[model samples]
Target chain A: MEDPRNRQYTNDEITVFWKPAKCVHATTCFRELIEVFNPGRRPWVDMSAASTQRIIEVTDKCPTDAIVWKYNKDLSENELQASTSTSEEVNPETLSTDPETKPAKVTIMKDGPIVVEGEFKVIDSNGNELKSMIMTSFCRCGGSHSMPYCDGRHRKIGFNDKK
Target chain B: MKEKSAQFRVIENKSLEVSGSFEIFNAKGELLKSEGPIYLCRCGLSENKPFCDGKHKNSGFTG
Candidate 1:
């Protein structure tokens, strides 16, 4: 049985499937391509904002298969029917609040930023609350134009984790 | 004791000081550290990789 909450977003060429149950909120989708996967907006996934090739590129980065894509011509009959219906679409905003209050997870990506997720507070050097967010990546390469955040500069400078 | 949420503090031109309840994992999904008040390298000059080793001072990292 198809999940009632599952959503399918389509452009002229491709359709993106969203399975909320499979989303661990690793936040890879929005962080990689917010122009298409912005969680703040209604209907959340805007396939038309980006090219099919670009959308597929970011969708492949999803740690989990919460979001995946298929060509419009390849969609099965049932899937094609679901794609046309907007009445069943659910808001991604309602899924923001994490149900489990587990301690935040800080993962150190090799040759990359420190990815933090779950409930957390960020404070500047002067002890002022910077902002509270569900997920964020801190730059370890020290070359980010956006201070304290990873702007993907490590790759440009060829940062290597020797360990 | 009531467990508090994790807190991350960005030190000026230096490391990121993390405290409170949280878990830290290495690149291979291994649990590296979970205790409070840990200093992580942000200046990218640390010989110790993820941990700060006072290399920022020499590197003159201002961010």
Candidate 2:
């Protein structure tokens, strides 16, 4: 079966593949190019939002090779068709709402919170919402008093990005 | 029996308390411990390392 999470984003010139299984969630892609690789958005990648060269530059920074790209001219007929079909189905807003389409992947942020996506239950010490986040950061710096949810305190206290 | 989700609690500005089914590993990916409500230092000044020894109060850690 084709892996649902193994997705591709294509512009008119090139296509970028996102293998969620290979992602370490170093946050390099989104941190460097939020306009194109926004984690908060469904489908999580917008190939048309940025230039092909810029997307390639950011994709190179992905430590795990989770994001890779190729020119559209290099693709086979089947690949070209698949890329077009995928783009037609691309709706960043509705991608994750269907539980069957995407299983949650927990991304260990570099010296930050555990960013969880897809479907999962999060409970606090008192079992509160702390907040039900689709893509939320959990404190790994051991600094957040809010427990699982990040309060952006890591930046205030100088939490080391390398742990 | 099902495994319980991991738990983490912040002891004010002192330390972070972690416990449950989750595992804590070092940079080398070695398993640290399972039974711990491990108290990890948040003050960024722990000499004992990872664990807290009431240094937050002395260091004036506001986190």
Candidate 2 structure quality by residue, lDDT tens digits, A92-125: 2224454343334444444444444444445444
TM-score of 1: 0.72
The docking category that best describes candidate 2 is: incorrect
Top model number, DockQ = 1
Q: Report the alpha-carbon TM-score of model 2 versus the true structure.
A: 0.47
| All candidates: TM-score | 0.72, 0.47
lDDT of 1 by residue, B1-63 (tens): 568889999999999999988999997899999998999999888889789889899777998
Candidate number achieving the greatest lDDT relative to the actual structure: 1
- Candidate 2 scores an fnat of 0.03
Stretches of candidate 2 above 4 Å error?
A1-6, A9-15, A19-66, A71-126, A130-137, A140-163, B10-15, B42-49, B52-63
Clashes of each: 0, 1
Local distance difference test, each candidate: 0.82, 0.59
What's the C-alpha lDDT at position B48 in model 1? 92
Where does candidate 1 stray beyond 4 Å? A1-22, A27-57, A61-64, A70-97
